[model samples]
Target: MKRVIARCLIMVVTLLLISGCNTIRGAGEDIERGGEAIQRSAGG
Candidate 1:
């Protein structure tokens, strides 16, 4: 039915968004760490 298809589509989209958020958070943490390393090397 149309309702069933719509529900499935919503669920898939929700899962994709949740996964994307985690990916972005992980990338941010990595960049922060790299910046910290540079600061330490510079004695700042």
Candidate 2:
């Protein structure tokens, strides 16, 4: 029983970490696009 609980807890934590990484990656892409737009507008 303890082993089962530990396995479940580890799985949940791994999923959360993966989701967090994806979220951060998406945010970085958005920021990059915004920066590109600003550069284009400024003719830089």
Candidate 3:
């Protein structure tokens, strides 16, 4: 029973980490696009 519970906990943590990574990556892309827009507007 203990082993089953441990496995489930690990799986949940792993999923959460993976989701967090994707969220960070998406945010980075959004910020990069915003920066590019600013640069274009500034004629730089």
Q: Using Cα atoms with residue i matched to residue i, what is each candidate's TM-score against the true structure? A: 0.50, 0.50, 0.50
10 residues in a row with least lDDT, candidate 2 = 16-25
lDDT per residue (tens digit) for residues 1-44 in model 3: 99999999999999986775588778688779889999999999
Steric clash pairs (candidate 1): none
Instruction: Evaluate all candidate structures by whole-model CA lDDT and list the values in order.
Output: 0.87, 0.87, 0.87
Candidate 2: where is the Cα deviation over 4 Å?
23-44
Tens digits of lDDT, candidate 2, 1-44: 99999999999999986775588778688779889999999999
lDDT score, candidate 3, position 31: 76
lDDT of 1 at 28: 86
lDDT measured at residue 6 in model 1 versus the true structure, 0 to 100: 100
- Candidate 2 lDDT (Cα, 0 to 1): 0.87
lDDT of 1: 0.87
Give the CA lDDT, 0 to 100, for residue 14 in model 2.
Answer: 94
Candidate 1 accuracy as TM-score: 0.50
Query: Looking at candidate 2, what is the lDDT of residue 42?
Result: 100
Candidate 3, number of clashes: 0
Off by over 4 Å in 3: 23-44
